[model samples]
Structures are given as C-alpha cells and as structure tokens.
Target: MRQHSTSTHLAQKSSWTHPIYTKKQILDVQTAHRKASSWQDRVALSTVKVLRWGMDFVTGYGTYSPISISVPKTRTMTEQKWLTRFIFLESVAGVPGMVAGMLRHLKSIRMMRRDHGWIETLLEEAYNERMHLLTFLKLAEPTWTMRCMVLGAQWVFFSGFSLAYLISPQICHRFVGYLEEEAVITYSKAIKDFDDGHLPLWEKLEAPEMAIKYWQMPENNRCMRSLLLYVRADEANHRDVNHTLGNLNQTDPNPFAAKPKIEIGLPQLQQNGRVKD
Candidate 1:
C-alpha cells in the first residue's frame, strides 16, 4: 500500500514536466485578479507596517537601521522593488532557521538527549529560503551596487537574528512569525500587480524553472500568479510553524508538526473564449 501511494505521488509530480497551459489560459489568471482585493488592503500594512515600523519595532528603531537604509520609498511590485526585496528578505529569512536548528542540535548532544525532531524542520526552512534567493537572482540579475547591498544586508541580519535567537528563542521565533506575515502581504501585493497587467518585466513570462520544479506546478497553473501563490502559501506555512514554536516550551512534546498543504488551482477558460475564474 505504501509503495502504491509513493508511485502515485511520483506520477502526479512528473505530470508537470510538460507545459499544459495556453497563453489564453495564463491571461485568464491576470483578468480574474483585477476584481480581487490586494495586499495593501490589509489593516496589517497600516498597523504592522512591515516595510518600516514593524521591523523598526522588532530591532528598536535606531538599534539596526542599516537593514532598511538601502530600500526605496515605493511600496509597489516593480521589477526593481521585488528584486531588492527578495534579495534582502531571503537572506534574512534563512537566519532564524539556522540559528534555531544549530542551537537545538547542540543542546541535544550536550544533554545526551533528543530534540523531539524539530531540528530537521528548521534546517529545511533555511534551505528552502536560500533556494528562493537563487531563483530570484535569475530574474533580477543584480548589478554591482545591488550585490554590495545584498552582502551588507546578509551580514547584519545574520548577526542580529543570531544574537536575538541566542538571547531568547521565543522572541526570536515571534519575530520570524511577524517577518513572514509581512512576507505574505508583500507577495500578495506583488501577485495582484503582476496579474493586473502592471508589471512589464513579468508580462506573459513563464514561471521560473526553479519555481516550477519547487512548487510542482500543474500544467495549467504554471504562470506568474501561480508562482506567487505557491510562494505566499509557503510564507503562510512558515508563519504558523514559527508562531507555534514561539509558544512552545522545551518540556512540550512534539513542538515540530507537519505543515498544512496549499491547494493548487488554475484560472479556467470558458468555451466562449472568456475567463471563468
């Protein structure tokens, strides 16, 4: 039975290797987005202020300003906006995982104990975010100045998050939860813009090869909107996981649990040649 299930899963995954969507189908996705509410509509943007105040509150306004100094004032999803955002955010996103995983691993070895299996999840989170960075670089193709910015941002964030995790794991996990909440909002806005015909850089562009493989995108759902959908789902999953971890005590059993899966769907086209989604 296990073998049969495994084989079925592999077949389902392999079905995405070939393109199954038409240009009309991809355009249908964008058309449907025009009627949807965007990420900016969230009250969290005004209250949490992920791009500015949320981060400031996390680090104590002046304590770590370099992280935000290089960013621009615009909040939309232009090519430049997403490029810089992902480059910096992905760099920092991987930090908490590494720090938490290493700390747990060391603690287990030292106490001659086990971690209740939390270390693997943390490490996988770090690896997945790192891949997100690499995937974006193929699109952004950063200049020297942007590369420098990435270098500086990674160094500061690594140090800051490491220190925070070391001092208080609960607070560190909470900060990550907040960060991912911001990430979900950011990607939603990007998806709205891209699907609403605002981003020329992504106009009629196919999903990145890496994104296609990582998300195991279905033949009909292999477009930019779908890509963003998968990425946002990942952030949402991370948000829940970190929030759970933040509330857990070391004595708690099974702090690590499986994340919920996001459903994959595509915009459908009607026989009359109109989008139905």
Candidate 2:
C-alpha cells in the first residue's frame, strides 16, 4: 500500500474536521464565487473584485509583504468564519492586478487599441487562473483562518512591491512586472503540489508564515502550481497594457521566459473514500 502521509491525521480531520473535500466541493466554491442568483451578490462580487484590484494596484505589490505591516488580521471565531469565507478573495488574487486588467480591457475594447484583442483575452485568462486558489489552499493551509492570513500576507507583500512601481514606473514597473510574472508561475505550480496532498503542517501556518514555508519546501516540481499560474497570467495581462501606453515599458525586450501553459481541473482527493460530490 502506498504510504499515505496524511493517514494519521486524515481520519482525525475527517471525523471532526471537514473532509478535505473532493473536486466537487472545490467546484462548489468556484461556482459560489462565479455565479450569483441575485443581482446584489453579482454586483457585490464584481465590485469587490474591481475595488481590490484598484486598491492593490494603488498599493499592494502582488508580492508578499512583511509581517510587521498593519494588515488588520485578527484571531477570533468570527475571524475564523471570515477567514474561510474571504479566502476566496486571496485565491482570486493570486494574479494580482488582474481584475483591473479586465476592467481596463473592457474599457478599451471599443477603442480598438493595437493590442486590444489579445490583451482582453489575456486578462480573461488571468482572471480564470486567479480563481484556482480556492482549492490550492487545502494543500497550503489546514484551517480556514490560516487561509485568510495567507491572503492578507499576499496583500502586504503586494503593498510593498507596488511601491516600487509607484516610485519609478519606467524602471521599477518593468522589473516588478517581471517579478510578478515570475510570481504568477511560481504560485501556479504551488497550487498543483499543495493540491496533490503534500505538506499539511507547513500549510497550517498563516500566509505570512507560508511565504517562508514555500521557500523551505523542497522542489516537488518545476512549475509554480495552478494557483500561481493564474497569478502570472494576470500579470501578463497587466504587462500587455504597458505596450499600449506611451511609457518606457511597451513590452519586455526579452519577452516571456517560457510560453504560459494553463490547465484546469487537476485531480483532487476523494471524500469519504468514494468520489461523490
């Protein structure tokens, strides 16, 4: 029999803890995030996406911030509920600045900018990747509260990272864009490994801590994971905007290191030893 690393705690978590959830449960989360029967929910979700995009771009760096910053994270039951519920925000945020791209793309779709067609598709692709984080967190964190911390830490990281861009758009944005692209790839592959049922203890730590945990973990694969892919894809969309602006960074002279390969629907754990939603 295969030596299941989680065998010891798996039953423990399954009994009182929520089942790790199969793909279906994960998909339910995706559906909750994407679809809204009520216009209010739809409007709220869209508003949240757009607003966070603006705030993150204006401040967040699309990278992990240090723990020293004031990010408003707290420890409480309500906080825990919010942690699990709001985790979707962080997952969607893997591709920092993506919602802005979509909004921008939509704004210019009629203008017929030179890169309009590909650029819009770029943002849409990135948006899809941003949504993958909901499932990847299972591998990254054991509890919902930790998930919020992970999400908040990314915000803090991006807060600092964006400062570089704010200070010097020409040089800093260029370098930062490249860094975000790398983050995209790195985080995407992270989704894959985490989802594959590796490293539970490490994941239980908060996002701020996971930043280091990710660094400590041995390389299980070359990719950043599906979650990160969404991140990079979004950055790619953001970069596409640079070419259109009358700015120094029209495009990376070096171009992408490797063509982005995005895949959806990775295998997930079965619930109750049977694959049923």
Candidate 3:
C-alpha cells in the first residue's frame, strides 16, 4: 500500500461529510456572541455562580477544591484495537488529569453545612458524568464493544460540569473553559487519527449527536478540518455563564474577550507531526 499523508487523508471527504471551521471561523462566532450579552442575561449566570460558589460553598454543598487522577495502568489486549487506544490515551492522559481535580471537589462537598436544596440535583448530574466516564472507559478499553472514545468524550461532556463543581463553581468555570476550548484538540485528533474507515454497529450510537451536530450544521462551518472551532464554542458557553455572574461581584465579566488567542495547529500525531491551521 502507498504511504498515505495526513493532509491528503483529512482533505479527502465524501459527499455527506460535514463542514470544518478554523480558528478564524471561531473568532467570528465569538464576535457575534459578544454582542448578545446583557445585564438581564446575567440573572441565571449569577444564580449559578452564587449557588455554585457562595451559598453552596458557605451553606449548600461545602468547601470544595479540584479533582485529581491516578497513574497510567498496564493494559490487557482486546479484539478491538481502538478501545485500547482510547483507554491508553484518553483514560490515562485525558481523564486522570481532569478527574483527579474533580475528585478533590467531590471530597470538598463534605465540608459543606447542608441545608440547601439541589444536592440531589447535583448528585444526579455528577452521577451522569460518572456514568459517562464509565461508558468512556468502555469505549476506550473496548473490553466489550466498539466505539471512538472521541464520541464518548462528547456524550460524556458533563465531565465539564464535574470540573465546574469540583472547583468553586465560580472559578470552576475557568476549568470548564479549558475543557471546552482546549479539549477539542484532543477529541479532534481522536476523530482524525482514529478513523481507520471502519466502525462497528454498536459503536455508531456512542457519540452520534456530536458527529452530526458539531460537524453537520447548515452553516458550512464544519469539515473536521479543525476541531477547536466547535469544541471552543462549547467552552465559551460554559464560561459565558460564569463570566456573567462576575457582574454581581463587580468583577470584570466576559473572560474569553480578553483571553489571548490559543493557536490551533495540526494534529500532533507523533514525533513526525506537523502543525496545521
């Protein structure tokens, strides 16, 4: 077989393929979202922040910190190679780093005085993230089934919330910001590199919506050419909620506005990788 190039592979697309966006495309979207902000728009944001940070910290949940992760583990093989890849890369690098911090946050919930409602609400969501992570593990390890853990990451998006809750919800959004914006590179590479051009039946369901919604919009903005455009959008929304809440404390809101543009390059596949826009 001829050696296929990464650029050639990414550029090659079928008729049904989705549009891809670049860093500039995302900045354009930011320009649009920037104008839509208002004081009244901040109400829900302030409530979420205050509840997440203030009352929840002081009265509701308890004092919380961040989560942490464990060391990488030795792996056993399975019929599905991709699952092993997911486990090795995502579970090891992706989760442990983010989740360790979230664990600390969970432990912090113990410091709270209780008396506040929404503990169940919080737990339910937390449970959802756990479930998603479990599914992620399944996807990564493929000890049982087949699926791209990239899709799993999308479905397991609640990991963002877990991150948020792990830290003071106020500042937690800062971490959420990382997941939303920075994480795309991880998932994007997963999609780009893992596409061996074959997927099993059950794997189809894992991250169907993400594959469709993120990539298949009418705006001609997706092509899987760049993952940061859409993934960063996800981070922006999480931060928007938090930034708006900053208004209550008279702190400067609108974080991404000033956030120095993080450059989006090509997939860092290996020592052989080259930067692409």
Among all candidates shown, the one with the greatest TM-score: 1
lDDT values, one for every candidate: 0.59, 0.35, 0.34
**In candidate 2, which residue ranges exceed 4 Å CA deviation?**
1-93, 109-115, 138-144, 150-177, 180-277
Q: Write the per-residue lDDT of candidate 1 for residues 1-277, one digit (tens) a residue.
A: 0011111122234311323434444333321111113342233224334445644332222211224433233433456666566666776787779888898899899999877667877887887777678667656666776677667767877787677666777666666766777777667667766665666766656666666666667777766567666666667767767765665655343334333211111111122222221
Q: Residues 122-201, candidate 3: write the lDDT tens digits.
A: 22233323333343343333433324434554445446545544444444433333322323333343343334322332
Candidate order by decreasing TM-score: 1, 2, 3
lDDT of 2 by residue, 1-277 (tens): 0111222221211111111223332222211112333443344345445545654443222322234323243311122232343244444344434533443455456665543233444344344444334334433343555556556766765674355434443443233233333333434433433554332433443322222132222233223332233333444444443322212232322122122311111121121221121
TM-score of each: 0.66, 0.30, 0.29
Worst 10 residues of 2 by lDDT: 261-270
TM-score (C-alpha) between model 2 and the true structure: 0.30
**Which pairs clash (backbone N, Cα, C closer than 3 Å) in model 1?**
none
- Arrange candidates by lDDT, highest first: which order? 1, 2, 3
Model 1 poorest ten-residue lDDT run: 1-10
lDDT (Cα, 0-100) at 243 in candidate 1: 63
**What TM-score would you give candidate 1 relative to the actual structure?**
0.66
Task: Give the local distance difference test score of model 2.
Answer: 0.35
Off by over 4 Å in 3: 1-125, 140-169, 194-277
